[model samples]
Target: MVVFKKFNLDKQSIEVPGTRVQGATGHYRHASYVNGLVEHIAEAPHIKTLYDLFQNSVTKYGDREFLGHRPYNTVAQTYSGYTWQTYAQINQRVNAFGSGLMHLNEVILQNPQLNRWSLGIWALGRPEWYISEMSCNFFNLVSVALYDTLGPDAVEYIVGHAEIPVIVCSGNHVSTLLQNASQMPGLRAIISMDSLQDTVPVPGATSPAKILRAWGEEKGIKVFDFDEIENFGAEFPRKHLPPLEDEVASLCYTSGTTGQPKGAMLTHKNFVATVATNREGLSIYLPLAHIYGRVVDTNATFSGCKIGYFRGDVALLMEDIQELRPTFFPTVPRLLNRIYAKIVASTIEAPGLVGALSRHAVATKLANLEAGKGVHHPLWDRLLFNKIKMALGGRVEVLLTGSAPIAKEVLNFMRIAFCCVVTEGYGATEGMATATVTLSDEYIPGHVGCPRAGCEIKLVDVPEMNYLVTDKPYPRGEIHIRGATVFKGYFKDEKNTRDTVDSEGWLASGDIGFVDNRGCFTIIDRKKNIFKLAQGEYIAPEKIENILMARCNLIQQIYVDGNSLESTLVTVVVPEPETFLPFANAITGSQVGLGDNVGLAKLCRNPQVNAAFLKELDKAGQAGGLRGFEFVKRMHLTTDAFTVENGMMTPTFKVRRPQVSAHFREQVQAMYADIHASTPAAKL
Candidate 1:
């Protein structure tokens, strides 16, 4: 059996009562790997598996494009366009740098100082950062990913918290890093992917080529091209491989902490299990970067599946897809919905003709699949689905969505547009990804599907002072997870980490969800996000957020706050410029200025807008999907969006609950102040 240093394999095994639960049904047929080893079910290995998979692919699809990109506007780029030997060479070059620093044990020795040897990588989306991560792992350094969107404060937090000695920034982030260099204490060197220009832009370019060019010309510092770095790896010995799975490989900062950043210590094993689960769950190669991709990449590498890296722009992603044609896409719900919206908006114009046709086409396909006529779509795809496919950069077989909830309409539209299966899964950084929808076209809207192999779930009673206090069974308590995919713990914060996982080893997801009799799971909202009214009624904002988002595509994000208050619930709204424009024009019969109106004066004064909001609110209550007490009362909407730079959101685009609450607390309180000032009771 495979084993890591800290996590005991035997202690984490799953043993049932030898009887299946009454409500839990067969979600999946046991795969051959498990069925073949009934008596000798092996322990799941971790990051070593990732290394092994890459080695295998280095032999198998050696000439195939491993990582591809298009840096410039017109041309396409690729790893396979070179050679497998070239990739190996790049690894060697990067490893040399890592090996040179392997003996620098200064980071581990100095607990949590400002310059203790953590790595800071800044790039919105690029492959060089991934290459840098591999090098850091080779040297036993912890890699900290900072968002390019992060303004000075976020940059300061990560740089200050990790005490990052070396920072690898793309063209986009180098200028900012240079300007703010004095703030970070331990930053000895900055590596850029693309070359820096004479006149530095406020936000530097994130392009790899420009950073490298700049680094090469700099004095007293060594710079290597990506391919040249690969060459260096060829000469570096592999003896300096960092400690495996049990060792902390990366520190990811999560929101909800008071001021300082809370680093989540993800071991090689924790990441490995997550990758394994993602592989078994989705059956294809997914890009690596985001947590979903990270898990999928692990699984793919472990299973000898080849991963094709795309330089992080949608145009490049599309180009890579047409060239690489990745069978599996690990994407966020927003991206999928955006793709759907784009396809529908472009292809179907007249409401009575093409629009109705598109709708019917999607509904019919779904209805046919429900009847068990499987895996067949008409040849007229050239006229119908081809254009849609082209819009997605053409060749996608399966698309996996997560990171947020997807609208059912968007899902349906994609199903018809591509004539392919679109599945979804859910989990967090703490647990990797534990559940995924089945690879069938008969998809149920809003369902996250089944748990992965070897995962056991249960509904536990919330503490009387808990987030969810509903008496209903499995009625939206925190979703607890138990599996090999559960993370080890957060680094240095034992109390918070221990509080997250129970004595029985169940990882508290903090998400409120329930499993149906058929074993399918649906997330209702977040337990931590629940707020109570003065009347003692609780409301889950996600449900309301979803309802509003579904009603109007214009609202990108919504935050409802009023749990501890009595009379009214106030909301902060971030409107999508593209989606909101047409609707605004429809109501005004002229071009709307809500575009640059930061005050949202037009939106607040418009009765049509208020009516639409109320319509969604009433539907949510009367649909009986929510408690009557959970209904939202008077609300105020704003057009300003919360972002990482503004300190309202994390790098992953999740709303920083405490930050958001604190930032908008003034606005929320102001509504009540306006109410009291207008009333005669205030005079009394």
Candidate 2:
């Protein structure tokens, strides 16, 4: 029952992947599976809950490094390298933290919500974050995650609705909690990860300690440092209250602008059954508020793997990775795309016969990638791509990316360049990070591989989009997921839960994709964020944008917005520095590069450059098979990248259309106005 094929790297070769599930289809119509219904491939049958998983790991691997983080020096205002905590140390703290929450102030023991008190964790991925989350599982309390970047308004809604009486948060988040503390009637206490004397104030922001003292006093809510709670719990110990398999372990709130956030209820069984599976220290970076991050951490902990946190600085992220030397690298496409661009740009700048050799090596490796070799070339890997491989720690054996669709070319480029298993996963928050990840053995470029173990995927027809199961080439429809991996329901959201997961338990994924001949799914369109033009052509901007990105590396991120009353479309693009800067300098006869923000910002709005860039976009779109109506009629170029902080992008790097539209409303209107004045100029 070995799920993975054993390999001997000494032989200079790795085992093939996903071979056990080749050509596997499911019982349901258009359904797909990695290994079908034959036991889900999860070997840890005894691990029924996160509580059990941790206990087992602690018993077996007590001396092993459980979690590690870089200590930020307040005096020097810089971070040192990683400091680790052993499994035994972490286990002791987990007990103390859970004990305090349950025994003191009757936190979970008398929640008044069936003794199922909900604790809120609002922070990035850190030791304290993971500890508090695990404490909830150990004590049978529900851990509710507030999106790391959510403002006071959304946090207020989630806090009030979930009736979270106590919130464990990072120092920076204390100010946000204080903003609406009075509105949260059920809230009784706040636990800050940093000490009041030590909480450093961010630029232009009030001190967290001051807000805590002021607001906590005014609201009659108790405030305690994270260490205080742990010490208190140790002093007044309580017995562990492990959860039942069916009990909800977490209340994860979904982020969107459509309506109030709906909490996705994930049970111990739902999670334990799926995870029970990872690597051998994960270089963690994704937010723990996300299911992807949480589950990855869960899997890593279960396997007794060390987890390292980034130094909380995006600028020095690569430096942290270089120091950590992680064997497994898990990240989102946005980050990987940046890394890919840097490598490609470096190859382009190599002056001499070296440049020609690099180009030839790229072509040869790409050909090898298409043939299912998968990041392996006896000659090229060690000789040509060793430096690129070393960039991600010199020991990265696995590379996984998810959250949004990655450019096909980028996917292939990464596979060849990283010299590792480069995979892309597809899933959503509601799915409990439910996914279909590409197999390392699969040579396919655009497809997210077949259904993962413990889950099943099917396609339901969307008539308006002209997608149906009966269509040829492949069946096209809305993606539906069902199985142990999917969330049971949304907390207290019966209507939404019912709407999302029908009687059959198939969770309607709102996304559109088609099952390929290999039983893989290539995400094509989304049901939401779709609009019809005045002449009546439905356009999936994401599909169009993905096409543009695959064909044109110059375009970093693109947003195509159109008025239903208008006959044409317009776009705002964030271009890659390496690709766009050279193009810009060539056309404008001016030299501008990264770090010259003022010059780059001004060049982004140059009319001549914008006009020329539009034609370049046209050529790319045409190459990707875009029709005349689908072509972008006008475009605005931007040096500014959309981000979660700007409210223009999601954590997963997908642009929030509503936010993007609002931010660019004036620019969008101006583009439309110009298009209207040049009515005769519109063409493919």
Candidate 3:
């Protein structure tokens, strides 16, 4: 076993080869697309400023789709929105709002107490963009986006943090904000884009439009409709530009990765560069609301591909896909799995007894895949895969998954079922849009693939920083990225900004990963979660955790620990309620949600479930995949999954290690307690 004197990593052997060439080949010409991309970048104004990119987009694809939205759940009932040519008009309306704000500034001059400029947005997707763009362009105001899913406390926290002066939300998002609107002292006017006449009968129900009118009358503030100003811009030619690249466009709060969400001041340049790098095809099932979706929208527009927007329940994903027939899909693993599950469920639901036969047929196809017979699904395709395809709008050429790790089984099933590739991409809000698995090239299931064109992927070794450093062959360490895609820095967070972006401009990804021999990068895990056992062997919990997540559906959350004490590697697992409920053979459903944790844990320890878990663990450990030292020796199931509300998971859904450890501290102690109690008997 390797023992380390320091906590930080000293050396790593993973690296991206300087160039992919024959052993003796000197050089080769750049690919044609590479040349075209470079030319595009060059002929493109230095974009020394972020506004330049917007101007360029407007100039080149003025009539193209910029931002769009539609009704939630309805497929054919979609809408294509105004382009950048109209974006100028949109800006003018925003400027008019700013002009109204300028009027409000005069009123503020009299009051002298009002100094903060904060704006809030609540519209589901497209309207959020309009308000955000307007806020950034007109007043240089900082806008805080509240996640519609959050409760009053989350909304209150953002309002308190940003000290917002103006709250702009659509009908859908305003009601929630109103729950805590009175708490925000600086909140002056609430503007509603959605007609709220019907909702006004309820206690917290009034249109922001009506609210704004009443508030403006009381405070001598002026209000304007977005549509009115939009019309005015078209009638009158208005040409005014905002600040340069250095100017902050939006204050994007972190996904609350830590305890509380810290606002990252993303400049226009940062967002533009991110958007530029993220330009890709838009297929069915992606909304322009997310950062990923926004990037896809820009990329599709530049690439001259039309994007179809769906604003409905993701539950109707099949209907949307079947109706839209999009060629590209950017999604997370969960959605894809659900689609596959739907396929499986649908197959089993059809033809009564024959549903069982159809399922067996699908299984036989997967078995054939393992035997290297190579993707021949005759009966399943006719009976099963076709429905899945039609449900997805039938023309998906590729599916892109990212954000979290995905199970290989899920990836393989989708690829085989859809006859399309499922590739993965990796990046952070800080990295903007640095690395991605390209669609035009080869596909690797687990690896995040190579750096996008023109990206410099280097692993920095900092043994003193608790990060592994290696330069043996393919250098492995912290993934340091320098590319057009990296963000400028965190908003007003000097220490974090300094820590994140090095003097040389390499952005520390915080994620620990390595490039394999093929130049394909695989994320091992988070650096902070990497721990060493008492025996001096370091273990990455994520690798083991990912395996467990894939192989054991019964385990919802797994935390591997053997760092400080070591009789054997141990884990705290949370049971999947749906999977474990059947095993309990419950007494007429005894109050489940919270009350079932103890029962669930005991069931996990039951002979059948324990054997299943151990068998899978051994199979995974011996799969020639994980290092021997990293194998799990002992494990215990927990009651619940780590969640954001409980402070165990980040908003982005990544585990909070410290929080998880704290929550499971007692359980961990008990595991060791039982182990020590049983030690004497084991010795005999």
Candidate 4:
């Protein structure tokens, strides 16, 4: 509960109360193996593989709920409250599903030329996704996930590259998979995650299911439902084929922000080890394909806890959370920002003493939190904060935010209002999302916590960024990780694999960081993403964007772009309508209450509006400690926010910089051209 007691400040480093980081590399590990690095998965020899983790949980918590989902009612056209299945039940299903896959795809599994069959999983965060994936683990089959945002080209590349023969996915992805089937030479069968019962019947032709079957028939591929496979597996059981620790379990494809998506071959050992290194979740909303989501679910399952699915609709997210009443919430900054805005909006709208009380409460709580006094305030909780807390499931005891840096003020505000442990995580897919995580006692924001147990971390000098391991009070350089949690390597990419991880096994994270004497890390820059301006200034776009986002209320999302060839920088600002509409009207002395799409677009194009935003941004830049060269010279505003569906953002909510540049290529060029033409030379 105290700041000074946060890290024991000793070599032993007992992490919080229950957890212990003994020796140099040990976090969330069993005390029995505290002498050195955790050799076995789950910190136990018995649980050597992921399947073992499942089996042990099933044995220990047989009656405990594992997965929960809200069944949709056809008659009422509404989703019911969460229904759960015990660990024993899911274990049975996993066994049957694995057996069923063998029964259905014997030819593909037993093919002479193929060494091992790889199955593809393409879906949202749902029970079926995990069920099908666990089945693969039961056998020694490799599992490859087709990310939801993957375009046709990326999908085809992954399917063919991984040689994925059978794909188990929801009915929604069938069309896209089939469209890319022609180019995917290894694709053989498609198993539906859900049933075809709900599929509307065709008017003149056969049922939609039949139409899909016929389409598959033409491509020499077979299609079947999830239950069909499970039933068959139950009828014809197959023995479990446990894999070695070194065996690749899943081929996780990157978001392909650049060219082709490269698969990171993550082993069962890698995942199982990471699970020990982080548990508890009530909502499964993030993409299961991402390592962050996968590790969280594994940790939850290992602890024999329940995880309920979101309604597959973002608009109804809070509604589901209120119903589920999850004790913990793991999320990104964007969601928290929206929640903060809503809370602030409501606080401002409250009349008379209520508004004053709300303001007083927030300010007092924030001050108390910063001083390490604690998050609890009986008066504030009952009179002011309980309603806001209920908005994110009243039971939430912990809030974990990651994938991007959250505003420090918002982080503190959430801690005050929700009265929970708010922690930030620092990780990547290559590390299986295992790395530094903020400690509960550490009230200070920005720095990610110490190294996770079993993983040895070091920093090598990045001369290009002028960062050295011997710098000042804190050592700064590129992050290098080597441990049980680190991934095997990129699939069939020896060059890139070699580039990423060196001969000594240190996985070069490409992210520049500074580590304090206490081992807390603050990520400063992306070595690869930073660009140099013509005026000899190095610019980290993400850092500038974060600063601007924190300072400027009008900017919902901003992508700061810098060309190495040019001296100036520019940005594509996606404005939040709540602030932007009103500001635009006031700034221009017109366009008041222009909340519609057309009106917003017009405001974006208006020269006066652009000038006003630039002025505001200039002030914000100076306020946030941005250098003159780093300030955005020109901006193109838009109402369309970057999203997963638009390929502008990854599933984790991080901006795809390359995609952003390509999407607004013309706008960027125009902005730069205007900068060049607005000079006195052009007038002359």
lDDT of each candidate versus the true structure: 0.56, 0.74, 0.55, 0.76
Task: Give per-residue CA lDDT, model 2, range 1-684, as digits (tens).
Answer: 012332221121111243212222232311322334322225556878889888988997899877889998979998888888999999999999888877655753354554588999988888999999999988898999887434467789899999898899988877667667778878878889978763555777777566677778787677778888898899889888888988999988865334577899988877775663222112232211112288778877776678888767677788888888776777876567567657765774477877787888988988877775566777877677987787877777667777666668878888788777777777777776755766545556777766655566777778876788777898778888777667878888899998999897778888888876656677877678765554334567787888888988888889999854465799999888888888888889999978788888787888888988888889998898676778899998987689999989888977888789889999899998897566432110
List runs of model 1 lying over 4 Å from the truth: 1-53, 56-64, 73-90, 100-117, 196-238, 256-259, 281-292, 303-324, 346-353, 379-383, 439-442, 463-475, 530-684
In model 2, the runs with Cα more than 4 Å from the true position are: 1-3, 6-42, 107-114, 198-211, 276-292, 530-684
Candidate 4 lDDT by residue in tens digits, 287-374: 1211127877787777666778886777787788888887767777756766776777677446888788998898888888878889
Which model scores highest in TM-score?
4
Per-residue CA lDDT of model 1 for 1-684, tens digit only, reads: 111122121122222334233333222212322232111113333235334444445555444434434445333443333112234543554566554343222332233432225777787544566567766665556788885433467677778777776677675666576566567765655666664334444566455545544643442223333343343345444465545556776777664222455677776666656655544434443332222255665554444444555556654454555555555566765456445545655446436778777666656666765565543467536556676676555656667676566667666667666766677667777776554454444445666765555455555445532534244453335567777667777777799789998786778776666655445567665556664443323356766666666765566787766643243466676656666656656766756554457424565556586556555556755564444545555455566578899998889988877788787788777766764455432100
Instruction: Identify the leading candidate in terms of lDDT.
Output: 4
Task: Give each model a TM-score.
Answer: 0.64, 0.73, 0.62, 0.74
Relative to the true structure, candidate 4 reaches a TM of 0.74
Q: Which residue pairs show collisions in model 2?
A: none
Question: Lowest summed-lDDT stretch of 10 residues in model 3?
Answer: 1-10
Error of 4 at 194 (Å): 2.1
**Model 3 segments more than 4 A misplaced:** 1-43, 46-68, 71-118, 138-144, 149-154, 175-179, 196-239, 275-292, 304-307, 347-386, 461-475, 529-684
How well does candidate 2 match the true structure in TM-score terms?
0.73
What's the residue-level lDDT of 405 in candidate 3?
A: 62
Name the lDDT of candidate 2.
Answer: 0.74
